[model samples]
Structure formats: C-alpha cells, structure tokens
Target: MSEHLFSALRRWPDIEAPNLFAVDASDRLILDEAESQLADIQPGELVIMGDNYGALTLGAAALHGCTGIRVFQDSLVGELALASNAGDLADRYRTHTLDRALLADARLVLLQLPRSLAELDEWAQAIARFAAPDVTVIAGGRIKHMTLAMNEVLVRSFDVVNVGRARQKSRTLTAMGARRSLERPRYPATSVLREPEIPVVELAVSAHGGAFAGATLDIGTRFLLTFLPEMKSDAASAIDLGSGTGVLAASLALARPDLHVVAIDQSTAAVASTRETANANGVGARIDAFREDALTERPTASADLIVCNPPFHSGATVHAAVALRMLADARRVLKPGGELWVVFNTYLGYRDYLNRTVGPTRQAGRNSKFTVAVSVRA
Candidate 1:
C-alpha cells in the first residue's frame, strides 16, 4: 500500500524533473524506518514536516490507515502537491505551519532534515515546546547532506540525540527527551548590510531560518546591483521577481526615487523577509512585498521593467525549468518594449531561453560564475 502511494505521487509544476519519480531513496528510507513504529503511532498523533511532495504523509496514511495526520511544508508547491496527490476532499490531513497547532500532542514526528543548522534548530525547538513530552522525532536526509552539526542543533532542544544506521545512503536522527522551551525563538535573524558606495544607506534584512542566504548579500545579487544604474525607470513601475530579501527592490527604490517597486517571491519566509528589509531601508512606501508563484497572477503588460536573480535550484534538484518559468512570467507582465534584467549562472544556458521567451537579449554584465542579461518583451 505504501509503495503504491509512493509510485502514484507527483511533484507539482512538473518542471524539468520527472513527476513520476518524486519519491527519492531518502524518502523510502524514512518511510521504512517509520513503518516499524506504525503500531505505536496513534492516529492524529503523527506529524510530518518538510515532506518534499507528500511522500511521507501519503505513504504513512495509506500504509497504516492513519487519519487526521498533521503536515507542515514551508513550500506552497509542496502543500498543493499533497492535496492533489491524496485526492484530498475531506480533512484526511490538515495543513499547518510551524506552530503549536501542528505539534500539539504530536507523539511521532517525521521530518526531512533541512540543510541549515538554524532551520533544524527552529524545528527542534518548536517540536520540543509543543509536542508531547515523550515525542520522538525521526529526521532523515541523504547521507551526503547529513552532517554532525545537525545533531548538535537537535541536542540543544532535546535531551538525547541519537544517530540511526545508514541505509541506502540515507540516515535518520532520533531525537527524544524534551527540554525546557526557550523564552524566545531564534529565527528571523536580523542584520544590517550597508551599501559601500552609499555609506549613508543601509538595509536591515531579517531572515527566517528558511530564507535563502539568510539576510546576506549573495554574489549574484551584488553583481546584479551594479547594473541598476543602467536601467531607465521613466515608466516608473518596476518589479523584482524572486526577490529573496527585497535587496534589489530596496536598492532600486533608493536609487530611483521616481520608481514604484514591487518585490515578489514564492517563499512565505522570503515575503516576510523582503517586507522587513523594505521597511527597514526606509522605502516601505515605495516598495511592496508579496508572496506569489512567479508572477502568474500579475496583470498582463503592467510592468515596465523586471529584475530577477532566478534560482537554478528548485526544491533539491538543479534545473532550468524554474528560471524559464520566471522569465516567461516576467515577459507576460511587462509592457510592450518593456525589459527584463535577469542574472543566472553562466553555464545554465539561460540566455538562449530568455531570447526566445522574451525578445532580443543583450549581455549586461558577466563574471566567471554568473551572467546578467537584459531582454525586451516582444
């Protein structure tokens, strides 16, 4: 039954990756490890966090007939995939965020180990604070991605952090024994990165654990900023697609006072981070930050210019479908003769995609690792 569930699953968006092959070896290992406790895990007491695409949740439910399962996935895409995969019409599994509602009395938690120590720390903290006193957390990740630091993070929130045997190049961390909850959570780390060219200007960036780069200036973004002066914003409506912390939006708003900037990202954490950064940079009035699925809902021909440093990685796999999707959306929302300025890895071969999707494309800047190009919407 569990194998059927895994085979039937599909990743939403069906991008460059295979939808039929959504479940990975790590997922199989996590499910195999969790199934041993199926008889002990009571219905409605099992919570799954960060299930990439409903593999753990649906597999558990279908395998053990577990109902009322609570699930928390940070990605909207993943959440949608869960509903679609389960044919969820009733409240078979309820969707929740990282909170007491998700963890309330949860006796068994199956989590996909995050790459960042800070993210794992926040998850462990929340699980400890709200889950049952005797809750067991089985967190699994690929062997190559697992590190000793993850155990260190879990140990801070739990009394015991035990490593499980590696199976099929995957390993699980068994965390038990809860500790006293901290008075305040450690997420949304805040810092200030001042513009060197304009010493008087600074951006206060606040990043939740899941945010990309965590309130730091990425090299691609830093390179993209140099071309901001080259843009003519007489049309006054500019968008920063895939805006991580609204750095580009804030910088553009500060440099071009006449322009109204909108920063959009798919991650909820990114939306919050971008809003905080814009407000702290004193351009809140001119900059609006919102969570969106790649400008799909934006009005056609509404924007004059769009800037983006599209992520080559969507979920765990490295692919160009996401960047292509973003470029297509940017083209749709840009007015005739409008332009899209996008930065990508030089080897991703995105320049040709941009040229065909938009109009004529020109190279604006380049380094060994990244390329910044401008494309006019036909």
Candidate 2:
C-alpha cells in the first residue's frame, strides 16, 4: 500500500480524543492526526465543532475508541456527509453555528486556518475565551500561507506559540494560555457599480474578514452575471448555489421577480453578505439566504434552475471535492425537468461531470478561461 494510505490509517485513531473541538476539519487531516496522536486514550465521550466537515467525528470512529462523539456543524450536514464515510458511526450530528456553543471544557482544540484574517481573529478570540490555560490549541495550515505574523497573533492571543517543522507543505502552531478579552474589529462595508453592460439595482455589499472579493466584485462573478439566462416566467424556484455576496441571486431576483431565490453558501460571512445584498436591492422578500454546504443540503427536487460559479479551491489547496459536491447536489435538487447552469475554467473538465451526472451537457457560453454549461435533466 502507498505511504499516504498508511499515514491516513495511522492518523485515523487520533480523532477519538475526548472533548475535542476542531474548527474547520477541511479534509480531516487534523482530525485524523488528533486520533493518531491520542490512540491510547481510554474510552470517553467526545464533542467536535466544525463548519460543515465532520472529519473529526469520523476519525474518532476509525480509531474505534470514543465512547461517543457529537458533532456541531453548520446547516450543510447533508453535504458534509456526502464526502464523509462516517454514515453509521456511533455519533450524533447537529447543524448549528459554532459560536452558539461554549468550549470551556474542551481539552484540545484544532483550528484549520481560514482564508480571512478577520475570521482568524474571531476564532482566536473565541479560543482564548473558552480554552483553559493548559488546554492545547493547535492551528495548522500550508507553510506558504502560514506566516510569522499569523503565528504572532496566536502567540499574542494565547500564552505561548510554537511552530512545528513543515510536513507535506503544512505546518502546525501549538499554543497554550488563557486568552484576554479584546474588542472585536468591526469590518467596513462597500458598494461598487456593476460593469456598464449589466443592469444595476440596489447593490451594497459588506464583507466580513474572510470573504473572497470582500472589497470588490470578482471578475468571474462579473462574467457569470453577463452570461445569466433570461428567466422564463415558469421559473418558479431558483438557487444560487454559491451565492457569494448574493450578487448572482440579487441579479436573478431583479430579473425574475416571480422566481423565489434561495442563495446558499458555506461561510457565515457569505450568507450575511447575500442577505445584505438582497435587502439593499429591496428584493429581500424574494430572496432567502442561508449558510449551507452547497454540496450537501440542496432542496431535493426543489429548484427549477440552479446557477453556480463554483470555487475551485478552499484556502490554498486545489481541492475539487467542493465543486464535485456542488454538481452532485445540483443534480439531486433540480426537478426532473430542471436545468443546471455553471461557469468554470475551460480546462477544469466540468463537462465530464455534468455529462455523467446531469446528462447531455453542452456549452451554453464560453470565454478565454471559462466555459458555461447548461445541463437539462433527462
């Protein structure tokens, strides 16, 4: 067997640590490591907090150690389950915001560094407040993105911070100490004009610390908007699967008032941004914003049309699981006669997945780096 598989097996046991809380269990690396790191721990209950990924909970089961494990994740539990193998594990999973729970009793806390510095600060403050003085807080990320300054924030927030040698282009920061109370930073909101060719409604946007293009409209979204189809009156329901800042959703609502638009994303900030965009455009009544894993919990056979410009990467890793999940969910949620519309870089091979999942996929539009596909359910 490959060394990677051996390492994965070795790391699977560490996830059973009693009272564990992992912030972002992206691909289950830290959760697997936690299980391996504490293989000898006696049977005991475990609790894990994650956004949408429940890798930590699965890690606990793979080790066959935890008396029981509970998971708190966002609304995308269905999507998280899509990529996880923990279907029958002895555990409880709930969909809720991580901030809703207190973490004072957690013995170990693992945080996967997020893309936004503001989110990092928020997580740091939450850890400092809930973690005990001796509790170990480990933050890990790819070495290229993890900086001395980021380490300094951990050090300043906790009592001490130590860096581990890089492995697999990843490094871990070990920190100890009770955090002090500090004022949370307030993020500013901004509004920008859409490209001249696109019609504008009310479009004010406020990004939290970690939003992609929190300060401006991304070129990809601009391209997506320009290519959006003119909605037919029969479009009763539509979904913006990765409706970042609600740009696509807002535009869809403005263009098709008869269609109830549901905008979904995995980030809290993205959800908030979408809601804000809807309200600013006076189309709040027509839009529903929720923080959800686009891969997991789409309305089953609920949408007549689905639109997405799926993100290619999470943080720095070019993981396609997210995009893959999105495609699967779109297939499941679209009515038998519904349509799925997506824009992706031409080289990403999205058509192959669409062909297999949605059937008879074809290019609806194209550009230098992107190809828009419209797949109709057979």
Candidate 3:
C-alpha cells in the first residue's frame, strides 16, 4: 500500500519534469527504517521533517494507521504539493513551522536530510531541545548527498548516532538519546555586509539554516544590484521575487525609503530570513516577506517592478522550468509598461526567452558569468 501511494504521489505546484520526482529512494528508505517506531507510536507522536511532498506523511498514515502527525516542510511549494497529493489522508497530518510546536513530545521523527550542514545542525538542535526524551530520529538522504559531517552534526545533540546499511544508493542515520541540555540554537545567523558596491552604506543580512546562500550575498545578486539605479525610479511598489536572505528587498528599501517592497520565496527559511534581514536593516516596516510560490498571492498587474535572480535548479536537478515559471509570474504580476529586471548565468541565454515571455527585452548589464536583463511588460 505504501509503495502504491508513493508511486501515485505528484510534485505539483512545483516544477514537475521527467527528472524531478515527488518521492525518491531516500523517502522509501527512511520509512522502512522507521517502520517499527511508526508502529510503536500513537497518533500525534509522529513528526515528519523535510518531506518533499506527502509521501512520508501519507505513507505513514496509510500503512501504519498513524494520524495527527505534525509535519514541517521548508518550501511552501512542498507544503502545497503535500496537500494536493493527500487525497483522503488530508486530515491525518497537520503542518507547522519548524519550532517547539512541531517537535514537542514527538517520540518518532522521520527526516529527509538536507544538503546544508547548517540546516542539519538546526534540526538536530531543535529536536534535542523540544522532542520527548526517548525520541528516535531517522534521517535519510541519497548517499551522494550525505556526508560524514551529517553524522557528526547529529552526534552533537544525540548521545548515539548509528549508520544504517546503504540500500538503493540511499542511507539512513539513526540518532537516539537527545541531549536536552545542549547549547541554544545557533541559527538565524547574522552578518553585516559592508561591500562598497552595495547601494546602501551597509546592509544587515540574516538567515536561518535552510535559506539559500545563508546570510551572505551571492555573486548573482551582487551583479543584479549594480543595475538598481536604472530600475523604474518612480515605481511605488516592487517585489523581490525568489528573495533569499532579503538582501535585495532590504537593499531596495534602504535605497528608496518611500518605496514599498515585498520579498517572496517558497522557502519558510527564506521568508523568515528576509524578515529578519529587513528588520535588522531598519526597513522591516517597508518590506513584507511572504512564503509564496512566486507571486501566486499577488493580483494580476499589481506590481510596478519585479526583481529576480531566478534559480536554475529545482532541488538537485538543474532544469529551466523553475526559472521559466518565475518569469511567467513576473510577467503576469507587473502592470503594463512595468519593468522586470533579472540576473542569470550568461550561458542560459535568457534574452530571447524574456523577449518572448514578458516583452521587448534589453541587456541592462553583463559580466563574464552573469547577465542582467530588463523587460517592460506590454
């Protein structure tokens, strides 16, 4: 039954392509590893983290009759996909942000190991700080993405870390004996950016573990910032689509104190980071951070300008669909004659695509690796 359910799950509201999948071997292996625990736990004791879709949560409910499960997914799209995939099992699980509420009294946790060590540390610390004394965490990931450091990170919060045998190129780590006396969470890492090239004198960037680039400015965003002076000067409202760490949003707000800026990203971590970054920069009042799939919540033709540094990859798979979807949303949300400015790797050749998708496009700026383009909505 679990196999059939996993097979039927879909990654909708996310980029669904041949290479991208809702469930993977890691999800299967994690479930297999936690089968005994799942059977032993009562309703509401099972907590799932990093479920790509509904596979882990729905599979547990279907196979073990577990209900009232608390689940936390970093991406808004992942949460929506889980709801969309949870046909009759929808009421079995509830969603929560990663906090004490999600982990409180959880005796069994099934985690899909994230690629970032900082993320793993944050999860480990949270489980140790909030979960039941006897909680058992079963974390799994593809062997290629897993590292010895993951086990090391778990060891800091758990007295024991056991490595399971690899199956189907995936492996699980069993962590037991949570150390509730451990140090406080070291997340929402903060940094001060003093780059002379930045529009603002100094920008405060804050990020939780899972936010992309984590409290640091990625080069793509740095290149995109160079063209800010050329953006629509009289625009009253702007959106930082795919905003990571709220650097662009905060920078824009600081540069233009009167302009209202919105920071949107699918990741819960990114939204939190953006809010923290904005607040730290003293622009939180002017910036609104939301966990959204692109601009799905914004009305059509509402935004005056949209700035994006679109991602080229969906999860670990490099695909064009992710960026294309963002571009389409930007086109839809911008008012007539409004501008959409974007920075992307030069090799992707987005000039012609932007021309066809948004409007007549022009090269705003370019370096060897990145190209910034501006498209006026027609």
Candidate 4:
C-alpha cells in the first residue's frame, strides 16, 4: 500500500498540493490517495481529524518541512503521537470536533463520507461558513455511501458542486464556492419505548437526513443485546462504551437499578439517540449519554463493569488498532477487579489482545458469528 502511495505521488507530481485537511482520516485508501496527492506540496500546514495510520504518516512527513499540523481526534491519538516524538509537530491536538482552525486556513478540505447524513449536513454547514470562495472541498466515499441527495446537500451548501466519475467503486465530490454563512440545521428529537418482552428499551430514532438506517435497531447490536448477562453484579458503576442509541445501557439501567451506567459514543447522532432512548425508557436519570471518542478520555477507575461492541471497521479499512485502543482505554478506566465484557465478531481476534492487555480473557459465551469475551483487571 505504501509503495502504491509512493508511486501515486511520483506519478501525480503536477497536482499542486494545497494545504491538506483530511477528516475522518483512517489507515486505508483515502490516506493512501491523500499522501500521494500531498507529497508535492510545499509543506505549510496540515490538519486531520483523528489518528489513522495514514493521517499520522502524512502529518509526520509534513513536519519534516516545519509544517504546522493539528490533529483533532480522541485523546489516545494525542497521547500516542506525543509519546512517539510527533508531539512537538502538533500545533493543537484536541478531543472534540474539528474547530474553526482547519476551516479558517485550509485551501483544500478532504472528508470521508460520514455514516450519518445528519453529521454530513452539520459538517457542510460548517464548511459553508468558513471556506473561502476559492476553497475546494473534496468528499469521497464508497458506492454505497454516495448518493444524489448527498450531492444535492453539497450543492446547496456551496456555489458549485461537481461529482466526479466513480473510480474503483469510489467517487469524489468537488464543491467550489463563496463562503456563505448558514445556520446548522437541527432535527427534532424522538422518544423510545420500553419493551416488556425483553429487558430492553427501544429508542424512537429519527433518520435525521443521513445515510444510516434510521429508527431501526442495528442488527449487530440487537444480536449483542440478546446475549447480555442476567447476572446481578455487586458493583454499582458501569459504562456502555460505544453505547449507540443506549440500547445496552438502558437495558442495564432498567434491569439493575443499583448500577449507574454512563453511555458514550463518537457520533453526535448516536449520542442523541442514546439520550432519547434513556428518556423514553424512563432510565434517563440512571443512564448518562455523552459524545465521546472511544480512543479519548479516561473516566478514572470508577466503572466496575464496561460493555462494548466495538466497531471493526472505520471507513473502508478493516483494522483492529482502534478496537485495541478501546480495550486499552477500558482497562485504564476499569477499577481493579473490574470486568470488561465485550461482544465482537468471532474473527476479530480481539481475544488475544484482551488477554494480553487487560489480564487473562475468557470466552463467556458464543454464537455462530459472534463471541462474548470477558477480561478482568488484575
């Protein structure tokens, strides 16, 4: 892959690399393409959201020319980069959403299509506000993630939006326009319904104008919830790590009133869903929802139990590093003797990582495609 990127760089030497900004940077084709595209630029400043392998490399290369680079992701990226001597290269690495710093100066912005359309709209609104008239925003995605509606949104936000021919099942959108100030659209929040059949809560989710399957429960999460343990723990504090829509967290809160569960997810939509689910289930007081990157923020050793169904893929890349980082963070925040219960696809090979990082791990249960693993902090 690196060789391919190097070749692309060598081949596309004529494309002037404007100050590059990559959103949702991951360790796959986008990064590879960006690196090849960015190699020719006289390094000045590079901004990226999150630490994917590709983004890290590009940021490192940019640093060689004394380029100012800023990375906004989860805290873990900041910590790892800092530890690896890339610390000084970072102008400001943060844990929240990409701020105006990137929007204010970036001549070219590269964004991977987000999973949700609501998120896409939010980002587009931001771009409309900060991007200059000459600035170009390039958005790319796999065939499934790209759509006419997305193109329409880009057109609405920018003066001119053009969709390029699909290459290798991926497409790029180029939007050029005068910076227009637009208010971010807000979606009405919905409520959830407590299910009597199962110890679960059903969140009433609105589509929020995104590509994600709306209102319906995710199949993977539904599968995980079915296997949730019925054992009552003596521990009072718990966390639903990646608690999308608060399905698992709401269940835990309803089933065990003594345990206080904090639900956290990276997506703003997911956070909103979780909150609504908690409220509808009447567990809002017990379940706290927050927007958080799994790789950032350490919540101390307060959680006696942590539950997660970690995402195996970010963008097009299927990598376990993010999941590994989540495990490490879970370990960091778990009290001594605390339990980390995780449900994942059987092939993810997270068992070995869990065993190595968070003491010995054991398969508590299993199904055809997924396995439940538990690790105890020593």
Q: Which of 1 and 4 is the better model by lDDT?
A: 1
Off by over 4 Å in 1: 14-20, 88-90, 197-200
Ranked by lDDT, top first: 3, 1, 2, 4
Q: Each prediction's Cα lDDT score? A: 0.83, 0.63, 0.90, 0.60
Q: Candidate 1 vs candidate 4: which has greater TM-score?
A: 1
TM-scores, all candidates, are 0.93, 0.69, 0.98, 0.62
lDDT: the better of candidates 2 and 4:
2
Which digits, one per residue and each the tens of the lDDT, describe model 4 over residues 224-272? 6665554337779888887766677877887787889888776555666
* Candidate 2 structure quality by residue, lDDT tens digits, 71-158: 4442243334423544555344333343525355555665666656656665666666754555666566666776677876676578
CA error at residue 193 for candidate 2, angstroms: 5.6
User: Between candidates 1 and 3, which one is better according to lDDT?
Assistant: 3
lDDT for 117 in candidate 4 is: 62
Q: What's the CA error at residue 131 for candidate 4, in Å?
A: 5.7
Candidate 4 has its poorest 10 consecutive residues by lDDT at: 7-16
Error of 1 at 143 (Å): 0.8
Could you tell me which 10 consecutive residues in candidate 1 have the lowest summed lDDT?
13-22
Top model by TM-score, which number?
3
87 Cα displacement, candidate 4 (Å): 5.8
Q: Tell me the tens digit of each residue's lDDT in model 3 across 133-216.
A: 999999999999999999999998999999999999999999999998846579989999998658877888898999999978
